[model samples]
Target: MEAEYDVAVVGAGPAGATAALVLARSGFRVALIESTRYERSRPGETLPPPARMLLARLGVWDAFSTLGSLPSHGNRSIWGGPEIAESSFIFHPYGEGWHVDRQRFDAMLASTAADAGAEVLYGMSVVDCSAPDADRWHIGLRGESGEAGTMAARAIVDATGRTARIARRLGATRQLADHLVGAAVHYAGPLREDGFTLVEAASSGWWYSAPVPPDRLVVMFMSDADIHRSLRLTEGDRWEHLLAEAPHTMERVEGCRPIAQPAFFAAVSHRLRRNGARGCWLACGDAAIGVDPLSSSGIVRAIRTGEGAGQAIGNWLLGRTDVAGAYERILDAEFEEYMAERSGYYALETRWPHSTFWNRRRTIDAAMRQQP
Candidate 1:
């Protein structure tokens, strides 16, 4: 007979793994489902000081601490002005920020959850999911090798990132923002001892670069999809031309050659109409709220929501009726605060007031005032 877990968390990314970790540690039977095994390279390598505290509380910081991630002092940015300004993490209680190997770092989180007693199904894709009864769900699974099976769970946690695939299947909708894309390129150069991320603004878009593990740099250009296409930023000289506009980034890449051609994809931000339902099932992390990467708080947001949801689900299943309502209220407040902060950050770059991206962003705060 297939074992019916107390909670089945889909997508073993930071959120799902953290949820599974928290639930398992609390003595709940959890099945951590993941489609990919975290083998490919991923962006968003910078971890700010506040995130470190969350990781420590989640009990996964030790695994990350041993990885020898680059110690990031702070950030130097050219946003809102021509002059560069440097902010220091030295002020934060956490002291230093660490740039890490995203792929390896994420895998370690999954491993930690497994070690904590969650049954992690690596490389297993959830093909289908359905509520078998009022209190349980029937989950269809398929392995990478093509084998298939079924499992059951008392509750489900959708940590599948932006798409909220599982939650959508269960009757949720999404609210999308303007088309946004981020083009990335990895560069290598002489070893630098100081660790500080760099950010610069341009009329068409904004640029951000940070150091990751193993002495390497990751540079990304974020802009609207229409602007990127219209400006032809992908072409050979044009791509380099934009980088040159950002002095700090351009200087560091003096002798460095591109590891590969620039790659761009949808960085669209969205949020679910309802984060989770009244039942024990819940949607947390990006699956619940997808934010713009400019915030550099995705990892922390994922961990926070995942851990919060795990406890909420545990209590709700154990017969607490008010936990579900409280959970929604908490997420609602957080989302409102996030939108306010997001608007303030985007407004900092008014250098291109007439630009489509900037104009839309400036008015975004008004548009976001209404909740769906």
Candidate 2:
């Protein structure tokens, strides 16, 4: 016999865990599925101070505060200029941000969801989803050992990040704006007490370095796909050459040894062509809309969207027909605001006015402005 649930959330990141936690707390039978066992390194480890409120709302503030995450006090940037600029969070409403171990943080969220009565399944992947009727969805799951299982759900939540696995399988098309990628490497060295994230802009792209909790430092070079390939940024010699260009970032990682080879990942800004709501299914987090890493809002946005999607789904299940439309409107407004802010930020960097990387941003910004 297949187990049944009121909601099945695929992908146990912040978004899926959050949605499962919310629904479970509301007395819904929720299933949170994760493909990984949280043993590997993941990106988006920086959490801004504003996320404190969201954590509190999720009832995990105490746990998070005591999670041994490193506190970040401010940021140092050389964007749009040759001189470094400092922005401190000392006066902000929330005292300090955090640099967390993504695996631990995500695991904490999944554990909390389980504690809240949600059935948390790790090391499982959703292989197929089919709806025999509009009221229920049948999900097929495969374990790490190739063990097969089945479950039925009244609704589904797609929290699969930028891939939008479940939503795409349901016919939602992703509308990508740019093909930005982040080539990141972690270094192990004596910990620097300074908790500031450093950002330096270059002719080709940008560089950022920050201390990963405990004793590791993470440094990444951000650029377009073509730029990354043409410059051979992944090669040892070429990567070091580019790093030398950003004195500030290079200095931060000095005397450190790379723990592993640079890993490349997509950091593109995109959204679904149609709002990710179809019958009893909806999408949240990067699965619905993804923003550029420059915004530093990835994790926070995931939590927000997850909470909203949970509430909206709960309402829809309780016979509220208007929640989907309302949620779609909220997503639309948020994306528009993000696009406007992103354009303004990119416009500030005129140091390499004719560079392909910078010019591409300018062209995209211009087209966005012309959009009705």
On TM-score, the leading prediction is 2
Report lDDT (Cα) of residue 1, candidate 1. 100
lDDT of 2 by residue, 307-327 (tens): 999999999899997998888
> In candidate 2, how many Å is residue 360 off?
0.7
Candidate 2 weakest lDDT stretch, 10 residues? 270-279
Residue-wise lDDT of candidate 1 within 145-188, one digit each (tens)?
Answer: 99998999999999988779988888887776656788988887
Q: Model 1 Cα displacement at 309 (Å)?
A: 0.9
Error of 2 at 271 (Å): 1.6
For all predicted structures, in order, the TM-scores are: 0.94, 0.97
Instruction: Give the winner by lDDT.
Output: 2
After TM-score superposition, what is the CA distance of residue 366 in candidate 1 from its true location, in Å? Answer: 1.6
Worst 10-residue stretch by lDDT in candidate 1?
Answer: 271-280
